[model samples]
Target: MAEEIKVIVFGLAHEEYGIEVDKVRTIERMMPITRVPKTLAFIKGVINLRGVVLPVIDLRGRFGLPESDATDSSRIIIVAVNDLEVGFIVDSANDVIDINTDSIELPPEVVGGIKAKYLRGVAKIGGSRLLIMLNLSEVLNKNEIIQLEEQEV
Candidate 1:
């Protein structure tokens, strides 16, 4: 796939990451998320988005990173994976970038301090711009999603 692919870029900590743009449904600013008890720490909670409840996962917590205070730039990236829509809390939801497949290289066990297993690849753009491509399947495949789907709240 040497053709250009669109990706939605976001920030977490001091690094940048990207997800397939087609998978993204929308981006919303920080919003109230009702916490769910007895759930994983990464599963922050769920939010009622336009009459539809979406499970929200804290990306930092999911990646085992230290939590940073949520800022105004913080956003919830709504994406559809496995026919289920969920929200991923990120430091910020930036722009949509076009990356040529040739610029992407296999993740080297670790990228931007996050495990490679959670990444699909790394894109080197413009010589110094590194965009870590996230593996949505791996990031959202935890059994918690199943639990969240069963939950009404």
Candidate 2:
């Protein structure tokens, strides 16, 4: 039997979420962000990752949560979305969990304000806590992301 694919999961506003570990390039702490005007409210700003500039999105803001200050636990999950490299700021980065295909289940019709189409599935880790598996492509599409980038310009 083939081994299960492990995903690096994180939390945002008390909700659990995960992404394929392979897509994640690296994780970094909160850095100085050059604020860009007229961009979406969810977008914090762009960050200089080494030599490359990557847009950083606040997951809490995107999910319509109350604004909170970044703490030591705050982290940016650098991921490649539709060939565009972007970073997502989350409350905290959790452990890398191994979840087999069998353990994954499709999300319900409604998940807060998030549509089910954006979710890959839901993984029940322990007893009551559920981890939402995210489809990066759906979550961050090329066309829409480009529009957001254009607004920054």
The prediction achieving the highest lDDT against the true structure is 1
Clashes within 3 Å, all models in order: 0, 0
Model 2 spans with C-alpha error above 4 angstroms: 1-3, 145-153
Question: What residue pairs are clashing in model 2?
Answer: none
Taken over the whole model, the C-alpha lDDT of each candidate is 0.89, 0.84
Sequence-dependent TM-score of model 2? 0.87
The digit string of per-residue lDDT tens for model 1 on 110-140 reads 7656888899999998999899999898888
Error of 1 at 42 (Å): 1.0
* Per-model TM-score on C-alpha atoms: 0.91, 0.87
lDDT of 2 by residue, 1-153 (tens): 635888998988778899989899999988998888877878899999999999998877766678688999999999996677889999999889888777789889757567787789988877687889987887677677578668767
For model 1, the local distance difference test gives 0.89
Model 2, position 3, has a per-residue lDDT of: 57
